[model samples]
Target chain A: MKIPILRLERILLVSIQVDLTDNDAMQFQSDLVEQVAEIEALGVAIDITALDVVDSYMARVINDTASMVRLLGAESVICGVQPFVALTLVEMGRDLLGADCAFNLGQGLEILRTRIATRGDTRLSEDENV
Target chain B: MRMSELPPAQIPLHETADVVTARRAARELCEQLGFGKADQTRLATAVSELTRNVIQYANHGECVIENRSTATHRCIWVQVRDQGAGIANLEQALTDGYSTSGGLGAGLPGTRRLVDQFHIESTPQGTCITIVLTKPL
Candidate 1:
């Protein structure tokens, strides 16, 4: 299934609610990268609160996707990792998720907005109205 | 320690989706066995990694989860079997940062640390891995 990517101003929001297979994960990765480039988004926040399990493969996909977003010139943050999932990943190994993280979507967006504001770059007029 | 057995639940793994199915089933069983939230997540994550390996390397496999609990033991046992090319290097596979599939190489070793017991038997015919989680009741 396609994970919807919503655009607000120059930012992208993606919420993954279902457990994704390997194929689905790859598809989502490519799709998110394509959208980031197509929209020239400034920041991205991926919410995974609904996911109960983040296995090695899934963790790899998310980490790679976040790096891909940064390579495309958009800052990204993974938001709302469940507590148990965090414990499991840490117990398994280190560096499973190397991307930036936050407690929830609201905090994720706050981080994104703050980073984008302090980036020392020109901001779009739409950002001025926010 | 002595333990009594319950009927095991079996899940056939043919594709990626089966990985999710297997983990979910294991998590539900952990819940019924009165496992804590952390143990449940750890078991589910370990199941996901092992089942995904079954599809990635073996192409097909099966996961059997048995609840072996007794008056003084709360235990959940799991076994995964695949009828495909068995792992060639068990030692290397278990070593950290060693992978044949360009992965992070955390599947085997990482799984070992998540549960109380882990064992593996592999040959040219196939591979079978057994893992168990137990708590004193």
Candidate 2:
């Protein structure tokens, strides 16, 4: 239930939470993710660097988080991907192709900023239309 | 054998991810040692394939990695050895898509394509396959 978190910037952070425990057949822990949904504003970048991976639940969580964030009106991103971690995610065959991603933390935040800036321009236009 | 004479790592296969961990460890080492991104990718891919082979064929084994270089040419050798059944036909095993076991079938052969040199030796104790990645400057 306790997820290790690193606050990168205000309203944006990284959490090293278990996607799944070793005893469970599931590769990731859904219970922890549900806990993360409780926090307000910004987005949580789950640190998957420690996990070896199996099955697609975590991938589904990743997929769901993207939509989940949009519904919450918060920007989201995934970070800390090592080579094998990425490979296993791909091999598991999930619909992660559209997930906003970064090779590491630094890049992930940068991407989220870029997309958010683009949305800012759109918001300005919507205000003018209104 | 001296350090130079020893080949690439042959990691022990305790888990399915043993090879992946070892290979990633090596690639990290290379990055820490100051190799570029492309070099790390090639070496890591080669090691990953071999480790996957150990799991499929022997179920468990160890990885032995060697870093050997001379002047303009640097070669890293990795071998994934396992104490399981010896390969019956080395040539057939090397052939693309000819896996006796149902894996990607590309692990052994695909690893070969990723590196500069590749060799496999099988005995009752286990199989010692060496993959060499040479960077010529």
- Among these predictions, the greatest lDDT belongs to 1
* Docking level of model 1: high
DockQ of 2: 0.07
TM-score between candidate 1 and the true structure: 0.95
lDDT digits (tens) for residues B21-110 of candidate 1? 999999998988889999999999999999999999999989999898877889999999999889999999999878799888889999
Q: What is the C-alpha lDDT of each candidate?
A: 0.92, 0.58
DockQ of predictions, in order shown: 0.86, 0.07
Candidate 2 CAPRI-style tier: incorrect
lDDT of model 2 at residue B45? 61
lDDT of 2 at B13: 71
Q: Encode model 2's per-residue lDDT on A1-130: one tens digit a residue.
A: 3444554442345455443322231223344344445544455554556544322333444556566665666677777656655654444233433567777776777776667677673341223446
Q: Candidate 1 — which pairs collide?
A: none
User: What interface RMSD, in Å and to 1 decimal, does model 2 have?
Assistant: 7.9
